[model samples]
Target: MASLFQRRRNKATQVERVRERRHEGFLRYAGFRWAKISASLCLLVIVSYALVDVTPRHNGGSWYGYTLGTIGAGLILWLTALGYRKRKMTSDHWSLKAWTSAHVYLGLSLIVIGTWHTGFQLGWNVHTLAWALMMLVILSGLYGVVVYATLPAALSNNRDEMTQMQMLEAIRAFDRQLHTAAQPLTPEDTAPVLAALDEDPFAGGIGARLSGRYPDCATAAAHRALSASRSSDAEAREKVVGLLSQKQAALGRLRQHLRIRALLEIWLYVHVPLTFALIAALSAHIVSVFFYW
Candidate 1:
């Protein structure tokens, strides 16, 4: 019975190790403690909004509005400080994970706070513009949460245990094979092969990265050309065609990997820039409200 118990413990440890290896990530960190906090904060703000009865149509100038506004503004500053918090590494309780967990939850809470600050009254003013930008930033952060949770799995599956450098190296090896194999082909057939070899793998920029659709893939063109040309000479065409197929398949995996990675990371480009923009718009909103006051 003791031996059986030990074996079960060992098996459980092995399973846990395997799970850790795949690595889902931080969005669901600590059993979604942050998500719960965010939900509760939102609920509290919303409940308070419904319960508190204010005059002058319940706008931003109210006392409760000022309280919510104070909290929201402080939240915006604190959430933005995550950029700075991330730069310094720490090992104790105030680790990056703790900071990020707080960032996500508290950032989410701001949605309620900011909305309540307006007393659910929106207008065509700098205040509304700031709120819009803040919403955009938060939406982008939520996108980050989604991609972070899901894309890592897809990325791992696509990689098949290969590293980024290894993927690039595999492409290089395929190119070399394609080049050597294509040398004997006729000039017309060789045009597409040369184009395939000559084209930069990283050429397509943001559109290609995002879409993962390389319509003008020289390797694909060469494969199509060679597939047709296979009728001319069975053996030689087969070799070149096979190599092109290999190259195309490898490129597809690479592109898929890149696309997943880009999806995982691309939200930051939207989130960070808009964070600054939100802060600036928020500053303008505050200044306009006070300057007019």
Candidate 2:
């Protein structure tokens, strides 16, 4: 009986430990294990690059350069495996969080590995092109890391305890109220209300979403025009204007939410394509090296 109780308690403690590790952020995974490893790798490469006496100085064709190139190429392929790794699940050391931590740090280490591979000998060739593409991919990845780390809090605060669907419903409710309130107004006054109702909440495209600017938004225009009205049914106009104002505020919050999401996701649009391009350039580079030799 005592043995059974001890076994159950140990099992419960193990489950709790797994739960705590699961909630920890990837950057701090295993207490920055990947960061330390990547830094050490870079330091070793830099020291080797400085100490090794490559005959006729260093260039991509040198023996030392070949070693760095091999390391960089392998690292790139491993880093790219992260996309596939995301589809798999595990709770041990090779979990998704650990894979991501390694991906980020190792990816950054390419700056050192790749630059040393070139041996400071850049030019207008496929070799240079591969290096440039790699740099671009890294820069975009860095942007992705920054936004993921910082913008999520802003996104949560903007949500204000409302689901996206709820926010849209709130806008629609205001629109219904505006429609009923405008019924007593003249045709001229009703025109703006109609325009506001007709406007699409998401019509501005990617640029507008990212910028959070809708200079020609019909709802905003309607609100302004109705607020300035001197019609005899001023009370009705005021009511419609008030509804428009509420709808406008709702739209602002929705757009702000979208802007943050866009910023969060736009890097992938750049990063993924550039990564493929880098691979192609890298392939070409390797082939040319062997072909010329």
Q: What lDDT does each candidate get?
A: 0.84, 0.92
What digit string (tens of lDDT, one per residue) describes model 1 on residues 107-194?
Answer: 8788888887887778898999999998899899989877877787899999999988888898899888878887777887888889
Predicted structure 2: lDDT: 0.92
Tell me the tens digit of each residue's lDDT in model 2 across 1-293: 99999999999999998888778788889889999999999999999888999989998899989999999999998899999999999978898989999999999999999999999999999999999999999999999989988999999999999888988999899988888888999888889889999988888999999999999899999988888888738778888888888899999999999899999999999999999999999999999999998
Alpha carbon lDDT at 39, candidate 1: 92
Worst window of 10 by summed lDDT in candidate 2: 230-239
Clashing pairs in 2: none
The CA root-mean-square deviation of candidate 2, after full C-alpha superposition on the true structure, stands at 3.2
Error of 1 at 288 (Å): 2.2
Best by lDDT: 2
TM-score for each predicted model, relative to the true structure = 0.87, 0.92
